[model samples]
Target: MARWQDIEKDAPEFAERVRARFGAGIHKTIATLRKDGSPRISGSELEFEDGEVKFGMMDRSLKLLDVRRDPRIAVHSPSLDPPKEAGEWLGDAKLAGRVVEIPPAPDSPHQDAGHFRIDITEVVLTYVGNPADHLVIESWHEGTGWRRRTRE
Candidate 1:
């Protein structure tokens, strides 16, 4: 797994685009594993701080419990319908990782909440190709490094 800074250092432009997409909306989606190993989708918000991806959950929330038991997590950026022109679409960003809890500071506003950071396994950004005639998928993985794929 890699830290957000590692991604940025490796691919500054791609990392910036992903961050911008995630920042485009306030509410993102997070997937956590339930006790039964089923996937649980929940609304979540995250921040890029101190070169790390961090998020919080309400105290004792189901999502929090889920992560505590199983740290694997996936986060999807907020979405908007594609424009009439596919070329105008901003596409989507996603990240999968493991959550590591951090102790809240004594005066932290989230002291009553659960604070955590992600050790990213991968980061993906999909968008329309330059001509907007094909789909472009770019990704970065911890061990494999960066790769790009396009589909007509």
Candidate 2:
């Protein structure tokens, strides 16, 4: 797993694109695992602070319980579509990884909520080119640096 800062250092342009989409909005989608191995979708607000991607949840929330039992998680950036006349959509960003639960530090800003740092295993971005051009999809993983593909 790599830190967000490490990714930025290694791939500046790609990291900037992904981070922009991630910061486009606060209410984003998060997928988590339930005890029965089912999937749960919830809203989350992630903070890119101190070179880490972190988030908090209400105490005893289902998502929190899910994280406690299984650390695997996936997060999606909020959608921002361009107008029909425009060709500059900001793109979609996604992050998949394990969550590391950490006790609040003595100097932590948020002490009332449960906080976790994401150990990013995969990051993906999707966007369209010109109207006549194909849609582009790019992905970065822990072992695999970056891969890209296009579709009509």
Q: Give TM per candidate.
A: 0.96, 0.91
Query: What would the per-residue lDDT of candidate 2 be over residues 77-140, giving only the tens digit for each residue?
Result: 9987665754576579999999998788789776766789999999999988677377888888
Give the true-structure RMSD of model 1.
1.0
Global fold similarity of model 1 (TM-score)? 0.96
Kindly give the number of clashing pairs for every candidate.
0, 0
Per-residue accuracy of model 1 over 59-151 as CA lDDT, tens digit each: 989999999999999999999889988898989999999999998868888787989999999999999987999999999999887789999
Question: Which residue runs of candidate 2 sit more than 4 Å off their true CA positions?
Answer: 105-112
